[model samples]
Target: MDPSTLFAVAPTFPMDDVRIRDRSRETMLRSPLTWLPLLGAGAMGFALDAGVAGFVLLLGATVALVSRYWKKRRPAVDAASLRELIGESNAAQDQELKRIIGSLESKGLPQYSLCLGRFLFLKQKIEKDVHRGQHFAVFAQEVEKGVDGICAEVCREITGIRAREERLGEILTSRQPTQLERLESARRESHAAILHAYTSLYQVHAEILGLGSDPTERETVEDPGELPGQRLQEILGGLRDEADMIARTHARIRRTIEECPPAVEAPRPEVVC
Candidate 1:
């Protein structure tokens, strides 16, 4: 059996002092080896005076059991507190994304491009933080939730950009009669490319939601075959490649939008007819 398959749930996050203490307390409770020395000492006490020693052993055992139960409760409380903190952090991150995206949208083209570049930088930072935190099983769900929310918001924004571009195209079709004839052909190709990009973004969002490992679409084999060595390398390199590819694509689309000229807002015609 695979080592990973053996564990029901993977671990998550950096273990803190509180977690260390709680783990140590639980270790003592679960292992009978912990009481071997105690039992041996109690036996020695018994040899000295059977009745008095028996009573002492009984008292000690009872104390140990009671102490174990008390220590157990504190760990539970610690776990609950950590979960609440994770929940709060996730909420804060959602608000942060909203603020950043809104500010970017409010800016002029050059400024918006710079802001988007910064957003991508910050987004990469958050993703790394979440991955590091994922090593501790206690916080994995929270990390996943935060990451998914970020990805979904990005996809929604991409869809919005596509819709905006379509509206701009329609206005151009009606207003710039002469220019439209020349540009309309090129516009169709550009629209198709943008739609394809939007589709990819939507798929990435779905994969994240499903907790699926990210995979890149490698070059299709002409003969419908893959070299064994290449296949192995792909399996090994998939996760990092998928993440990098996704980030690059998103960054490119953002930069394109930033560089695009603002649509010429057509003046409303006066009632002449």
Candidate 2:
């Protein structure tokens, strides 16, 4: 392996809206530190025949219950499971991005390859941000549902594309006009499908990053869409390592997809503009 061979970073999607913090707040509200004393206070008031005080305590308890009901935050996860899944998701996305990069390189579209790399870096930065106590949920639930399934679909779609390309390869000995048109049509459709896959991939990244705020109202934070030309060239050059790692890494990712459990398909995102 090359010294700079890609390694795993924690894959995180922007799931800031998943209510992890809400659940934490609710948990603390329900903990013994708050409710247990309230219960004790209520009991003591009743024991002393302090009817009005007991009613007040009961009212406080009712408020607490009502607060919990109103929040109704969900997708709660314990700390351990949360951490484990985060690590797993990080690995899955890392591998999948590698595969995508390799496929893009093969298609002679270095700019798109670099675009995806920058997006992956943005995702890595999110994980780093959360780790540094920024918008973090020590007990946050998984963000962006169906992430694994969407990644798996990307893998499956590329696999089909590769198979079709090979079939086309076997029949192209003739220079006949009809054969050339058929091949040209297949190539066009294949590129379109690849573009669609990339569009969905970018959407997944955007949702995880929570870039939903109005750009006109405020200066948006860093964007991967407008990656600088020189920087993109640098990224593409970086992908070409001494060890020829792309084929090996892509193969490993493909084998992983085949060996893993069946992926549940989610509704595909529309092609981005």
Candidate 3:
């Protein structure tokens, strides 16, 4: 995979009015100015010995008043500020992608580039779909996290491969028969671990692609079918399992390499008298 794929043009959709409304509502709901006054009104009604019915009426009035006040006083969601925040977030993600790709390139592991490329491609695709709905926006963030995890797993696999190669080189040069046998076993185990990681990554990639392919699937549903978010969680969960396996395999190989004794010189054969 070409590292340049990571720099694919981000979707340029302007935040729609619906999304803006959603954002404003979310912000307003979280602010003390929205809820604290309601609480205060309730307290005042109780302190004044208002009956339950009266208190309820007072609280209802307070809500209407609060709503009207908020409608006028709430600051508009500044488009420029939102764009800046998104730009900053995208910049950070880009930096991380570059860091991962740089490490892979430095380690001469270009073979894994395809995995990274597919990840970025799917990520951008999902972002475009997510822009269509406020409900889907959270999935965009989840997708980012999932891609980050897959990229990290790819890096770990590359590191493990490099380490395995070095360890094998040491064992081969040592010319110890026992170590040679152990080396073969380690190679098989490492290969299996790498395969497992790739399988997990491919599964995640396919699932993400599925999300982008079907509009129906992407819809927030209340029925029996799986939700996009739930599927995403499963994908991330698989990636986590693969990561754990890679870590364990790496540690095991390192231990094997370290524990293998240095080459012992063979004693000379004595001639019979």
* Every candidate's lDDT: 0.45, 0.47, 0.61
Best candidate according to TM-score: 3
lDDT of 1 by residue, 1-273 (tens): 112111122122333556556555665556564565566657666766658757676658766765666566766646655655544544554454455445545543344335334444444444444334233243344434433433444433444444444555655745545444434433444444434433443343333332323223333331236532333233223422433444455555555444545556767789987
Query: Candidates' TM-scores?
Result: 0.31, 0.36, 0.50
1 or 2, which is superior by lDDT? 2
lDDT for model 1, please: 0.45
Total backbone collisions for each predicted model: 8, 2, 1
Task: Please give the ranking of all candidate structures by lDDT, highest first, separated by commas.
Answer: 3, 2, 1
Would you list the clashing residue pairs of candidate 1?
11-135, 11-136, 11-137, 12-135, 12-136, 12-137, 13-135, 13-136
lDDT of 3: 0.61
- Candidate 1 TM-score, C-alpha based: 0.31
lDDT of 3 by residue, 1-273 (tens): 334323333322333556556666777788788899889988998899898988999899989988997777655444434544455555565566566666666667676555555544554554445445455455555544544554455455555555556666666667587888877777677767766755665665565556556566556442457655577667676664665666677688778866889866557699999
Model 3 misplacement above 4 A: 1-90, 93-96, 99-109, 112-132, 138-141, 184-195, 212-230, 264-273
Over 4 Å off, model 1:
1-59, 62-233
Clashing pairs in 3: 1-114
User: Where does candidate 2 clash, by residue pair?
Assistant: 11-90, 14-208
Determine which window of 10 residues in candidate 3 has minimal summed lDDT.
4-13
